[model samples]
Target: MPEPIRTFRHFRDVPDSAWRWGNFSPAEIACRGTGQLKLHPEALDKLQALRDRLGKPLIVRSAYRSPEHNRAVGGAKASKHMDGTAFDIAMANHDPAAFEATARAVGFLGFGYYPRSGFMHIDLGPARTWGERFPVRAVPFALEVPAARETLAESRTMKGAGAAGVATVGAAGVEVAQGVLAEAQGAVLPLIPYLDSLRWIFIALALAGIAVAIWARVDDWRRGMQ
Candidate 1:
């Protein structure tokens, strides 16, 4: 037996458990002008099945219009929307031909193409089609690359560069100190050898950091080319 059509004054009146379709909400199918909702379970079932098959969002433009809202919107006298069995879906994220094929497979018998408005209407009424087909797109919308989350602290090249910069500054400061200490303080003469050793260590660290930075740059370039 066919599921009986149900009506609600507002989408909020719908019980949470009664809303079984995972991809659709009662609010989405409510009358745009009045907030009233009429539900046809089999129609929604077909719609949900279509959504599941497409594996993408179905952007509903209009659905479940109240009789008054339908008339105000200049809908056909016997529009399926008043019966809660029609939906106007945006085509911005869909390829019309593929979408139509899938809609048919999911038991949507009515199709009204509004290419100028960028939406297509599908219904569970008698089989029919209307209006111009969408112009062929060179490509459907492509998924974007995920964002990178690497921070400066996590970059090995940056770490090496920081180490090198700190070492270079430390070595220069030590040299200046040695010059002043040697000329003014004969008591601290033994510290000069240790300071000389530290200067060489800093120079070595700076060179090592430069090598790491060069390696990192090359690796980045190679990966980008790939």
Candidate 2:
């Protein structure tokens, strides 16, 4: 049988002094950049516990998000942030794995490691994990343009030189053309290795996206199971 969904009152009852993390405040966690913050009691409790265990300041990148704000940021349809049960914390000073471990020990069920963006997401939602610790650098397609242009110019020069003097151009022009072709090839050949690397990077990114989607589905299933 499917378990009943847990409901939370959308309000903040805890006093300011209750939040041990002096650096973080309810105002910063509020939706739409407003000072009015509403958070699930358990979420706040676990977060504070995690902060205390770490013995360091935790920078909250994002917390409670309004439905409109969530949509604008392309958040998941049933994002925990909407219910103030999620937090995206900066990973600058904190070690990702250590922070994640502390968060889990403090009862956060959802974990997302985004080393590229320098932030980790923790939430009191269905137990799930996603995202990459090492980010893939995108291949700049612009680099290829210059190499292609040089190749084209070399080909055009070869053609014009050959037509201008078939006699003198026959031997000397053929030699020069071959040299230009070699130069162009030299310019283009190096990019092949780089292009191959980019192909793998693109494939990896696609696979990562698919993995995240599958993870979300599994998390939803787990929620149902609960």
Candidate 3:
């Protein structure tokens, strides 16, 4: 016997994404309705709180799912959404990062900000998040070269050139490469400060342990001499 999913009547207006909804399998529906989703009641509370705090509907673009629904949407195999602990939401024409910040302030877990997708993914499980905001630029195709004129006069340097009229062109090629590199560095920057703090903390702990060991040895020697 378990508690039912705490559903807010106001949230009924929110859209349900691709889930089987009323057609969900018995087992799946039971899982979502139970306390197995630890934050079943809390999810409803936070959803309403977000709506009030943001002064918008804060539409739920997706919600609890069955395994079949999960497979159809290409969801991660271990998604919390299936258990009624996760929800995807979007505010009409709102910046996802700003909206996600709002969600984080409310102490909701799993706020994934996907700006391009125009929505944020949230869950009531672990306090963690991950999602890309911007578009992904791919390597550009090379430009074609015009035929070289063999009969035209050329400079000495032109004669020895490896290829004729095949020089690289346009800012796009350079821009895409830099964009990817910058994205990678931006991703790593968040971890660096935490890592530095840990390094200093580990060193301090090591020194403290060494001092304690020396004091213990000194006490042992004194007791033996007594």
Best by TM-score: 1
lDDT value, residue 91 of candidate 1: 92
| Poorly placed runs, candidate 2 (over 4 Å) | 1-23, 33-36, 134-226
What tens-digit string does per-residue lDDT give for candidate 1 at 1-226? 9877789999999999778999999989999999999988999999999999999999999999988999999999999999999999999889998899999998999999999999999999799999998887788767668858568888867877887798788889889988987997678898999989988998898888878877877887797799
Which candidate do you rate higher for lDDT, 1 or 2? 1
Q: Quickly count the clashes in candidate 2.
A: 0
Which should have the higher TM-score, number 1 or number 2?
1
Clashing residue pairs in candidate 2 (N, C-alpha, C atoms within 3 angstroms): none
lDDT of 2 by residue, 96-192 (tens): 6677778888899998888878899999869998987634335321222332333544543444443433433234444455455556756655555
Question: Which predicted model would earn the best lDDT?
Answer: 1
Question: lDDT of all the models against the reference?
Answer: 0.91, 0.67, 0.56
Query: TM-score of predicted model 2?
Result: 0.50
Query: What does each candidate score in C-alpha RMSD?
Result: 7.4, 22.7, 30.7
Runs in model 3 deviating more than 4 A are 1-39, 134-226
Runs of candidate 1 with Cα error greater than 4 angstroms are 143-226
TM-score, model 1 to reference: 0.68
Q: Is candidate 1 or candidate 3 better by TM-score?
A: 1
